[model samples]
Target: MRIPTLNHILPALAIFVSGAAFAGDLKIDVSVPADRQGLVMAAVFDKADGFPRGTPLRTATAKPVQGKATLQFTDLPKGDYAVTAFLDENSNTRLDANLFGIPTELYGFSRNARNMAGPPPFAEAAFRMEDNAQQQAFELK
Candidate 1:
């Protein structure tokens, strides 16, 4: 008898499966510019809904260095997730905005998907993560 690795099973079962998904923290390390540095609040959303609200959620914040920061998400349910973060120089948890709700600070989303006119759609931000554990590194633009 042989035991199959998760890599083989995951695809066979589909990209996602009910009652089976990775749980726990997914560590992310980000390398960013020194000119824009501050506390980075990462919003980890399962979908567009329940965002900036409700209790079922995942979030992480990093104390920025001049050039880099490491973020660790705790107890994140394995599934589709989008990570959006901003350089909060003002120590505010919310995005700093201009007159028209346009952001004044450096911001980013997963996959680095940017919209021509505004924010990317939720589908664009979505990334499928496996259960158990994972680690990733992203270089900010």
Candidate 2:
């Protein structure tokens, strides 16, 4: 057989690479407290370092309907991920904090993980995303 040209082989390689990147969808169901009503923000982290701090691999926002909100991150490769979400009752993009640096707004973590001293460690909040669609729920605290 004759060797294929670079242009012909490149296109096939690109399609194969991109197909692997489009893995699955992550659905997050957030339960907001009845007392709070506003925008719901969520972040998806793929690593432990800078988690719940720096920019996440994906972000989603939605308005709570009757104290519940659903967010989805599509086309995420199969891997480990953690989620952090909060209710922005004041319409601010960032989570509001009190004078003591404690969060004033309602927040939640993946697997409903929490700590008495502070936020839960990344390991406590991590979940695996496999070949199929994955779903996780969190109740605001």
Candidate 3:
């Protein structure tokens, strides 16, 4: 309701708008051992990280070589997040496993947290995006 007050709010608005400019574009380097097929897909989460459940904020697919891949999440909000991926050897869109419960597809998570019985919690995989541009390297377990 104050006209001159707009001047005082301009700086805050600039910072807010600047943050949106780099919302996504979260660059992530993934290093994982692909299955025999050499196909891999990385899922990156923004606010909610998939662990113990593997819920992804966003997912990107790539063909890995030498057990390594570079994945990126465009338009990701600057916040706490995590990432994961699987070999997708069968390309079934889901990680397959044998009767023994061993993953048929090579799979991994951020922070390389491996649970013997189940997936890790989001809190365990969570990391902060301190800058407008963020980068991280996640190794597949």
Candidate 4:
């Protein structure tokens, strides 16, 4: 029988330790208009490729009450992340946009970043997540 040497085991141990140390949780607080009634939809992205329109790494929904809604994404690896959210008042599972490509629904992004033409770029809204709980807040526009 052969026993593994220290060199062989060190690399494997480092990977395991690093990965385990980086798992974290993110809590999102969204403020909606008190008169609005619908689901607060959110999506989390790790990259800029799809951004506001692309498929997200994770998605969640929370019903608003008293002008506030909260959602949590747990066990995420340490990295850069951006969030986009909207108040789906009509419950169509999508943001309502007007003829000029302007959104009619209340919406927001991480860092509260906004652009005159469209959604803010990923870099503008990206945040670093570490091995601890983090909180982000947004208000519907």
Candidate 5:
């Protein structure tokens, strides 16, 4: 049998490699209160510089139902990531804060990280995304 040429083999190899590259999914479950209504927003960060602030590497939003909500980030590559979420009660698409910069709306982080003097650092919320689907839970406070 004649062997296939590079032109024929390269395309198939590329497709195989590309498919393997995106073999992970990050699923987040947010526990919202039944009385609260609005949107559940989340942010994913690959670095600590602007973690829990600024723009994130990825973002997701979902509406709560029966005191629960879920957000899924699919086709993610293996790497370190941190997540932060908030309950947008006003539907303004942004977390509200008081005059002292303290959040007035409910918020949460991956691993259930809590703020002491300030928001939890990336190290506290960061998680590794391997070659499998992973799930994380957060509770609004």
Candidate 6:
């Protein structure tokens, strides 16, 4: 085999370093009531527009064990992010609300931010993901 040249090695190294510089992982821990059933869904948001309601940059799900569920997001770009989590007890792929538009199911947001009228604003829930790994916790209301 031929020895690798400077041009070949430099370009490969640059690509690897650049790709790694902007990526990170996030681990989430969700606490739910022991009586609760079904899977826990978590979503990641990258921008304030649309926020906790609009489409998410990524989503993850896991079943709770011992009243806690753990989920992880890998290879996310290093940037500001917000998270929303819900316990989908009915497995309907949606949060259930009562006739008054008040949520009947358990749900929460990053930083545990809450608003009396509705979901918290993106700014209230946003967190910086600057390191290679980060963690967030949520307790469903």
Q: What is the C-alpha lDDT profile of model 3 across 1-141, one tens digit per residue?
A: 757588789999998997675655677777875445656787766655234355666778887777677777776666778777777767688878789878876777777767777666666777777676777777765
Where is model 6 more than 4 Å wrong at Cα? 1-14
Pairwise lDDT winner, candidates 5 and 6: 6
Clashes of 2: 0
Global CA lDDT of candidate 4, please? 0.92
lDDT of 5 by residue, 1-141 (tens): 999999999999999998787758899999998998989999999889998888898999999989999999988887889999999999898999999999999999999988788899999999888867999898988
Rank order by TM-score, top first? Answer: 5, 2, 6, 4, 3, 1
Roughly what TM-score does model 1 have, to 2 decimal places? 0.72
For candidate 5, report its TM-score: 0.91
Q: List model 6 lDDT by residue over 69-110, tens digit each.
A: 999999888899999999999999999999999998899998
TM-score of each: 0.72, 0.91, 0.73, 0.86, 0.91, 0.89
Name the lDDT of candidate 6.
0.92
Could you tell me how far off, in angstroms, the CA of residue 125 lies in candidate 4 after the best superposition?
A: 0.8
Tens digit per residue, CA lDDT, model 1, 5-112: 998998877756633554767777766788876787777778777543333256778876768778888666667877777778787677787998778877777777
Q: Which stretches of candidate 5 lie over 4 Å from their true place?
A: none
Candidates in order: C-alpha RMSD to true structure: 8.0, 1.8, 4.4, 3.0, 1.5, 2.3
Report clash pairs, candidate 3.
Answer: 23-76, 24-75, 24-76, 25-75, 45-57, 50-55
Clashing pairs in 2: none
Off by over 4 Å in 4: 1-15, 18-21
- Using TM-score as the measure, name the better of candidate 1 and candidate 6: 6
- Over the stretch 62-113, how does candidate 2's per-residue lDDT look in tens digits? 9988888999999898788999999988886999999998999999999999
